[model samples]
Target: MLNNQKIKKMHKLALYESGEGKKHLAISNYYRSDYIGLALIKNFFLTTIAYGLLLLIYFGYRSEYLMENIHKMNLALMALQIIGLYIIMVVGYSILTYIYCSVKYAKAQKGIQEYYKGLTQMKKAYDREERRNGRITGRRTKA
Candidate 1:
């Protein structure tokens, strides 16, 4: 039996292939949101690691300076700065990724709409030809 996620994927593929504009758009938007959410989570992990390394390097290089000001340095302030920097990096990366994905999805949707339009025209022409012939012309299954 197919799971819910698999079923949804299949439905999306059907909508895409059948060129159902409204349904496809709705489903695609859901998919895009899910993608963005996952990307944000992944970006958070990456940004944290990167910023952590940078902080380590900065502290290492400034060891003497930090030592000199150790008496005056407020631990709370330092902790807050690190936390704020991490939040900033994660948000910035997530925004950039969201924008990029949105543009790419929009372009793809346009192309899919065009494909649907062309398919519609073709079907209309086929129906018109069938009517002109006074009978359907296609393979028939044996009863």
Candidate 2:
């Protein structure tokens, strides 16, 4: 005895599992705050590395000027300016990462909720089939 409704639901579930379900499951495993925090940490490190590379390129381009002005330049002020720029870059990127991760986590949780609802429906269908076949008792108790 094959149920068309059950078969359709099963097909849908299979498609989801093969596609976005993997990402949704992985995202749902983490707490919202934890996910956002992890993203922020990664963002910080990436920003730091990018900034370092930019500094190296800038110094390379100005090598001749820097060498000529080495004795005349205000080294302390220049260092302060570079530190300030790095701080700004890191803070800006962290804020964006936090917002993006928060939204992503929320969406994933919503998807998992829907998936669970589908599973519940499938379970009920199986119970109904069992009752029709006289394989079980009067009522099906949920666990």
Best candidate, TM-score-wise? Answer: 2
Q: Specify the poorest-scoring 10-residue window by lDDT in model 2.
A: 134-143
**Model 1, residue 53: C-alpha shift (Å):** 1.8
List of clashing residue pairs for candidate 2? none
Compared with the true structure, the alpha-carbon lDDT of candidate 1 equals 0.72
| Alpha carbon deviation, residue 25, candidate 2 (Å) | 0.4
The alpha-carbon RMSD values of the candidates against the true structure, listed in the order shown, are: 10.7, 2.8
Query: What lDDT score is found at residue 109 in candidate 2?
Result: 89
TM-score of each: 0.55, 0.89
lDDT of model 2 at position 70: 96
